[model samples]
Target: MKSSAATDNSSHHVKCDKNNINDDGNNSFIELPPNSRPLEHQIAGHFYDQSKTKYGLLQHSNGDVLKPLLNPPRGPCEEQFYIDVFCQTSKSKYNSEDLINLRKFLPHYLGTYKCQKMSYIILENIIQPFKHPCITDIKIGRITYDKEANEEKIHRMSKNSVVAEIGFQLSGWKIYRSKYYEYHDKRCVRSLNKTDILHGIAYFYGAPIHLRLDVIELVINKLNELQDYMKQQHTFVLISSSLMVVYEGDDNDQELNKSTFVDVRLIDFAHVFPQTNSNQSDENFLFGLANYIDYMKQLLDKNYVYVPIDKFEHDNKTDTKIYSCYKQLLT
Candidate 1:
């Protein structure tokens, strides 16, 4: 795990000045350090296809991620949320263990970084430890849009039947196997049904049975821990956010010596809202969390292991192998 020492000092807690950031599309004015580059595994968020230098996340040399402050009130909202969670004051009301435990399930916020008048949120790269990380981003909650959303935004979210029916949507996934990274981008995820989503989960953990079980057990435990923390808190509602699940995919068993093999963290807090109208916990997110946990637990049972091979077959990657329970048992 990354150290919190970088954010311990008060100097890192610089207040976000909206005027200082350039949210406009123009990217020529901004200048980044030579050591920084676009985050290679970023699956979602605003991105420029033509220009890698302009938008999206930047990974700094020290292994910290710099996320540009987008247009408000999302930009400001996410910044404040991180501050409340990491830079808690002596008199702050959010100091409860239920909320503070969130640090374990989130990227370490080392405050903000400013460059050439453009502001960015400095965060620890959660996947920095892994040599080959198999990652997936699942957007949580059936109700994706918050109460503050406009009609168009509400309609757009509501139209996503996957989120409405499943309580969660697979945004994108990248798996490492056969010495290659297999990408299932947002466009690919959009075509999947509930069953395909489950298969995708299995595919993510596709490896030797021993390795697969080890990763699944650790991931489920982490999800349960995160769920317990959320159940105890009635302070906030998470909307349009995702749970990023990562595991080492290298053939070498580096995870054996580590405390954990899998890493699950919550990301994309731009739509997080406070629970002001009622004292009820975030049922919208909790419902999704419970459902997600159930799916993960099913993997542990080994009742079934589904692997979508049509894509690989179409690509003529006949040599590539996906682990299946039947295949493992037969061998």
Candidate 2:
């Protein structure tokens, strides 16, 4: 095994004083009389091994009972086994932002027995993606490294570190590489996919009916906020995949009794891009905005109230009701 220059050889050795003897030839260790020192100071002296200067219980503290180390400690063999296993498994796996995110679920998936009984297994199996989503449902397979002989070909267009191979029940299996612009930072290498979106949608759909309007508005508000942020940053925001939006919470202040605003978040940016003159034109923006306005109008017609804003807020109950009515007409 490779060793670091700072490794200490004496760390493994145990030290004890043998000269303090009793009548039976055992160590004649005696606790300090109560008045000799403060109770805490005496307890600290009894617990701490003064000869080694290590913090540990003394043999005489519990009437000659050898108290174990207060802090649970792992044996050297177990520690080495964990390090070796972690290194080997990490090397074999592909690296990606999504995969890193998914890796957080590994501990719970592996279970306590595997984690405690075997140190090597805890590092090895937990680091690798499970065969089924039921076992490892984090979409890690979408960013796995290819072990095939032709891996070089795949690496040329898509760096092995940022891409993952994912299997879909409907499409059989496919490998999608992260667009170069998406993972410019090394820390952004993880396999986030459409499954994450579907999960969010399902969650909102199952939310209580009382919260549906708040949820929908929250989703719309988030997109608007992202648009505003992008405008400020002088970057165009594009939602390439349909699953970019998620409803998180209501936007109301507790102290004030006014209607709360909705909260939304964008995730899995593997496919988002800034609009350019060649790809996005003024006409395109107007067309897209018109379609979006129409969609929002439909929602309003259906009694789905939206946060009222200056210039954007509709007046006249007839016009407001038409917004929801238009939504049903399109359907």
Candidate 3:
């Protein structure tokens, strides 16, 4: 519901009229509607960094999202990745089950949009189905920096040592509870221990017991589907990507729609690259997925009380059965 203020970068300015967008041959690239605004609930990726851009995703009038392409190779690489997965043609070579089934776990790619010499990738808004959505962005993979990372970038990422310890990090989350939303940004979890992270996850799915059970179970099922796809493929090394978990946060019984209750999708593919060799799967991504799944299963197995984050901060020594779930990670 928020609009990004006009930035110094002219490329980011929306200057398209209906005719300019509609004339892009075959009508594949649609124009940004006048009402399009920056997505307010975005949790992860470059969007949150003030210097990256004052804007992130623009929610279109048709309920889709317009994601601006980053500069250079990162932009082109992401565009090509989507094209190879979705726009299958006679000349394309990325048709493996790994790539094909990606649709099951990723936002549907509509097409590319170019306006005033700037480009954007249009994708289905993953949260469109929910009334009030509780969302979390979990960055996957232990080795987040790719071979392309410069020394400075590598040094910066290395400082967040939790990624190497647990194979993933709870980058950010926005939860709706008691008619209000609580947000924890990426910086909050960077230095957290494995136990504190577990508490954070607990706080994420902090719905009423009955609703919490259903949401966690469904989310776990979705993760399993992604896990199955990741295990069988040795195609791309997904780096610095994230698993976006969203669920309906409107707890009213009448508003609860089981069909649209929870959704999971893979997001942020700027660093995704083909594997060095055909025989090796992306173990780094799989390891993170596996660890997250284990944590969810433990939640289902035990009735662990959901501790409010503020309470956890003051008295983290709460002896709940949930802490026993990932004893290995803590040690």
Model 1 stretches with alpha carbons more than 4 Å out: 1-31, 48-53, 90-97, 207-211, 254-258, 307-331
Writing each residue's lDDT as its tens digit, candidate 2 over 235-330 gives 222221112222212223255322322222221122222345433322322333333323433453555433321211235675454332111111
Against the true structure, candidate 3 reaches a TM-score of 0.80
Query: Which candidate has the highest lDDT of all?
Result: 1
Where in model 2 is the C-alpha error above 4 Å? 1-211, 228-261, 272-296, 302-331
How are the candidates ranked when ordered by TM-score, highest leading?
1, 3, 2
TM-scores of the candidates in the order shown? 0.83, 0.23, 0.80
- Model 1 clash pairs? none
Question: In order, what is each prediction's RMSD in angstroms?
Answer: 6.3, 24.2, 10.3
Q: What is the C-alpha lDDT of each candidate?
A: 0.72, 0.26, 0.70
What is the TM-score (0 to 1) of candidate 2?
A: 0.23
lDDT (10s digit) by residue, model 3, range 236-328: 889988999999877676857687799999988888877877888789899988998887877776676554444233224452322211111
**Residue lDDT tens for model 1, 1-331:** 2465534745253343444434466655344444677776666665533344456688887888888787789987887777777776554445445557677778878878776555788887988887778788988999988888899989988997877877988777777764567666665566667667776677668733333777888888888888888888888889988999988776476555456567899998898876774567888999998998888777777566566544323233332333111111111
lDDT of 2: 0.26
How many pairs collide in each candidate, listed in order? 0, 20, 0
> 90 in model 1: Cα distance from truth in Å?
6.6
What overall lDDT, based on C-alpha atoms, would model 1 receive against the true structure? Answer: 0.72
